[model samples]
Target: MTLATVESGFNGEPAVFTAELKPHRSLGPIGFRVLMGLSVAVTLINVVFFLATNALPVAMFFGLDLALLYGAFWLNYRAARAREIVRLSRNQLDIHKVTPAGFVRKSQYNPFWARFDVARHAEFGITDMAVVERARRTTLGKFLGPEERDSFAKAFTAALADIKRRV
Candidate 1:
């Protein structure tokens, strides 16, 4: 199962909830940090090349490189907010990349029939990721941290079991 946090509103106060995803994997915090780190390293290489060749073009090249990097990061940010993936099999819906926890769905959930559901997820602290539960699908939680995914899984499975018993 996957784990996530959910919250609403932006005035620094809002309702919060926790969520559980079926089971899935996604690039975590480490991945993003690595990607950014690599880009910076490549920029350094470009600087070295420019210095060695005495090619004034290096400045322009660097500028272009920086621009591309900026765009990439900006889009990644957007994607993180876009709520990339969500899939539901049963009454329960598995939220994908439910931010603040980096949740990925694996199995399935019956939305209506299922008695229990994860209506909330991890807290929105540094990552601002919080999973919200909806009968249908809702766009929320896009960014994620490293350890949250694991936590969501445990919570989600338990919720499912509880729901089944209630039903």
Candidate 2:
């Protein structure tokens, strides 16, 4: 699920912005299972036809192809576990990144001092985005599409500007 929250801070302070970003997968769990099942069934049927024609090696190669395809889908599902959470408050901006292997990393920056950097390409639109504080830079939303990244950049920049104005 994609979650974006903008809340007022305690004691009537500036609004806080929090966004949770995840990779968008076109196929859901049920769709993925159905796709894999159909592929395997088709491959097995082809393999059986080859085996009946005395082409046993071709059947074995078909099995290997199925194995590779399953492996690729498994890896894609595993990597989908990765996510990024960004929180911008009046005092600080925090980013939490979780890897597919369950590793977690965090970065913090002063909202008053941080700069939002967006790298754009002529054809592709936004290519990258990050928050820069002093000499340190933390990249964010690596999994988001170009349009999503652009929308996020605008919202995040507005939140930062609001905090600066309040301060």
The number of the candidate with the highest TM-score is: 2
Q: What overall lDDT goes with each candidate model?
A: 0.48, 0.83
Count of backbone collisions in candidate 2? 0
Give RMSD to native, each candidate: 11.7, 4.6
TM-score of each: 0.38, 0.88
lDDT of 2 by residue, 67-88 (tens): 9998998999888988887887
Top lDDT hit: 2
| Clash counts for all predictions | 34, 0
Stretches of candidate 1 exceeding 4 Å from the true structure: 1-55, 84-146
Cα deviation of 121, candidate 1, in Å: 23
